[model samples]
Target: MESPDPSSSAPVLLNIGGKKYATTAETLTQREPGSMLAAMFSGRHTLPRHPTTGAVFVDRDGKHFRHILNWLRDGDIPVLSESEYQQLLREAEYYQLLGLADYITEKLSWKKGDGTLETELTRKDVIKCIQAQKTRFRGVNLSGLDLSKLDLSEVDFSYACIEKTNFSSANLHKAKFKLVEAACSSFEHANLHECELTGANLKEAVLDRANVQSANLQDACLTGCSFIETDLRSAHLQSANLMGADLNGANLEGANLKGAKLTGTNLQGANLQRAYLREVDLRETDLTGAKLGGANLLGTIR
Candidate 1:
C-alpha cells in the first residue's frame, strides 16, 4: 500500500473575525493560485495562528467569507444583496482574487437593479405609462419593440436593454439613455436634441437624418452605425467609437470628436466645421469631400 501525502492529510482551520471555518489546504491553493489564502498555505511562509486553538487568524469580516469559500470550492456565487455583494467584493480585493473582483465590478455596473423597472412592457403599456407621465424606465428590457413615431420626450432609460427597438420620427428631446445597450436600434428622423447617451452601446444602429443636436454620447460604442445626413450639430462624442460607421453628408458642425476612434468610418461630404478632432486617429477613415474648415485637427493622425 502506498503512503498518503502528509500535506493532503492535514486539514486547515481558520479564525476569521471571531468565526471559525474548517477547510482543506488543497481547497485554498488549488483554485486561486494567486490569492493571499493560497500563499499563506503554500508551506513557504509562517502563518499567524491563534495561540489557544492553533488556527490561522484572518482579521476580516466573516459575514461574507463563506461566499468566498464556496466560490473557491466550486466556481459558484449565490445571489447576494447589494450590501453583501459590496462586502464580498471588498473581501475579494483584499484576498487578491482578481477574477472575483472583476465579476463583482461587472455586477456593480448594473446598479443592483433595485427599484428599477426590469420587466418587459408592451407598446400599450408603454403608451399608458407615457400618458401617466411616468418618465423613469431605468433597467427595463424593451428589446425588439416597435415604438416609432411616438412622443417619448424626456424619458429616462438608463441601464436599459433597448436592443433592436425602433424609434423612427419620435420626439426624444432631452431624454436620458445613459449606459443603455441599444445595439441595432433605429432612430431615423428622431428628435434627440440635448439627450444624454453616455457610455451607450449603439452598435450597428441606424440614425439616418436624426436630429441629434447638442446630445452627449461620450464613450458610446457607435461601431458600424448609419448616420447619413444626420443633424449632429454641437454634439458631444468624446472617446466614442465610430468604427465602420457611415456619416455621409452628415452635418456635424461644432461636434466634439476628441479621443474618438474613427477607424474605417466614412465621413464623405460631411460638414465638420469647428469640430474638435483632438487625439483621433483617422488614418483608416474615408474623409472624401468632408469639410474641415476651422476644425481642430490637433494630434489627429491623418
Candidate 2:
C-alpha cells in the first residue's frame, strides 16, 4: 500500500529544502537530536510560518512529523543517506524507539571486503556504531557472521545466541553481558573493561587476553570459557557461577565474591586480597595460592 500521501492536500505539510510536500509535523522536538535533522539544526532549513501555537512543527491539521520513528519501527525504510541513517539511530534510541536503531546500525555495521580483510566501509557506518547505547552487541544471533576488527564498544549482549561468531580484535569497552547465552564464540584480544556478566552462559567461548578491568560477574555461568591474563581488578563476583572456566592469571584483587560458585573453574595466581567469600562454593575449582589477606569469610560453608 502507498504510504500516506504527504503531498495530499492535508491540514499539515512539510517544506524540506524549499520543496513543499504534505507531511505530519511532529510535536515536542529537541534540536540536534539526530543526523537526519542536521540540516534543520545547522540553520539550513528555513522555518515555515507557524500553523498552531506559533510553533515551527505544529500545523493547522495538527499532524505530527514522527515519520522517522514510524519508519524505524517498521524496518522497511527506503534508501537513506548515511548521515540520515546514523541520525535516525540516535534519535530512535533517545526517543525509546526499540529495534529501530539496532536495525539501522546493523546495516551500517559490516562491509563487504575483498577475500583477505582490509574490508573498508563508508564512514557513515562508523558513526552508527558510535551511536549505539552499549559497546558489545547483546543477545544478537550473529551466527556464521564475520565481524572481525569492528569497533563495537559498550554493547549489552545479555541472553544472546552468538555461536561461532568471530569478534577478533574488536574494541568492546565497558559492555554489559548480563544473562547472556553465547557458546563457542571467539573474543580474542578484545577490550572488555568494566563489563557486567551476571548469570550469563559462555560455554566454550574464547576470551584470551581480553582487558576486563573491574567487571561484574554475579551469578554467571562460564563453563569452558577461556580468560587468559584477563584483568578483573576489584570486580564484583557475588553469587556467580563459573563451572569449568579457565581464568589463568586473571586479576581479581579485592573482588567481592561472597556465596559464589566456582566449580572446576581455574583461578591460578588470581589476586583475591580482602575479597568477600561467605558460603563460596569452590568444589575442585583451581585456587592455587590465591591471595586471601584480610579477606572476609564470615558465614562461609567449610
Candidate 3:
C-alpha cells in the first residue's frame, strides 16, 4: 500500500507539536517552494503521522503555526499583537522564511510619513503632549529604528540611549542630544547643522558625509567614529574627545576646536581654514594635506 502523492489536491492534516490543523497540499507547497513545509511535503521521504489521528507531526510551536499556515494559504497576515508578531517572526526565521521575517521587521519598524510635511504646528502638539505627561527620554531603546529622511530639527533626545539606530539622510538641525549615549549608531548623510551634543557619547558611530556645520559637541566622546567627507564647518568642539575618529576630506572651515582631544585622529585632507585650535591635543594625529590658513593653533600640542 503506497502513500498518496503530496502534490495531489488532497486535504492534509497537520499535527504541529500538540495542536492539529487541516489544510490542502497545494497550500503548503505554493509560493515558497524552499520553505520547510514545502520541503516536508515534497515526498522525498515519508513523514511520520500521528498514531491515533493519522495527521503529519511537526516539531514546531503550535501557537504560532496558524500564522504560518495563514500566510501560506492566501498570503493573508493578521494584525497581531506585538508579542505575537515577534513570536511568529522568530518561528518564520527558524523555518527559513526570509521574506516573511523581513516584511514583519519593516512593517513594525519603518516610520511611515514624509518628514518634509511635518509642520511646526504638529511638532508643537507632539512636544506639548509628551511634556504634559512629564515623559523622560532615559533608558528608552530605539535600536535599529528607521527614522530616515525626517526633519527632526529641534527634537530633544537628551539623555536617551539610542544605540545602533538609523538616522540616515535625515534633517537633524539644532537637535538636542545632551548627555545621550548613541554607540554604533548611523547618521550618514544627515543634516545635523547646529545640533547640540554636549556631553554625549557616540563611540564608533557612523556619521559619514553628514552636514554638522556649527554643531555644538562640547565635552562629547566620539572615539573611533567615522565622519568621512562630512561638513563640519564652524562646528564647536570644545573639550570634545575625538580620539581615533576618521575625518577624511571633512570641511572644518572656521570650526572652533579649543581644548579638543585629537589624539591619533585622522584629519587627512580636512579643511581647517581659519579654524580655532587653541590648547588642542593633536598628538599622533594625521594632518596630511589639511588646510590651516589663518588658523589659530595657539598652545596646540602636536
Best by lDDT: 1
**What root-mean-square deviation over C-alphas does model 2 reach?**
14.1
TM-score of structure candidate 1: 0.65
lDDT of 2 at 269: 76
lDDT (Cα) of model 2: 0.59
**Model 2 segments more than 4 A misplaced:** 1-139
Candidate models: Cα lDDT each: 0.86, 0.59, 0.78
Q: Roughly what TM-score does model 2 have, to 2 decimal places?
A: 0.53
Candidate 1, 89-144: lDDT as tens digits:
99999999886776566546554456343438888888888876758777677888
Put down candidate 2 lDDT per residue, 19-82, tens digits, no spaces.
3444332311222235343323234355555455322342222121244524522323544556
Predictions ranked by TM-score, top down? Answer: 1, 3, 2
TM-score-best of 1 and 2:
1
TM-score of each: 0.65, 0.53, 0.55
Between 1 and 2, whose lDDT is larger? Answer: 1
Worst 10 residues of 2 by lDDT: 23-32
The best-first sequence of candidates by lDDT reads 1, 3, 2
Which model scores highest in TM-score?
A: 1
At residue 197, give the lDDT of candidate 3: 89
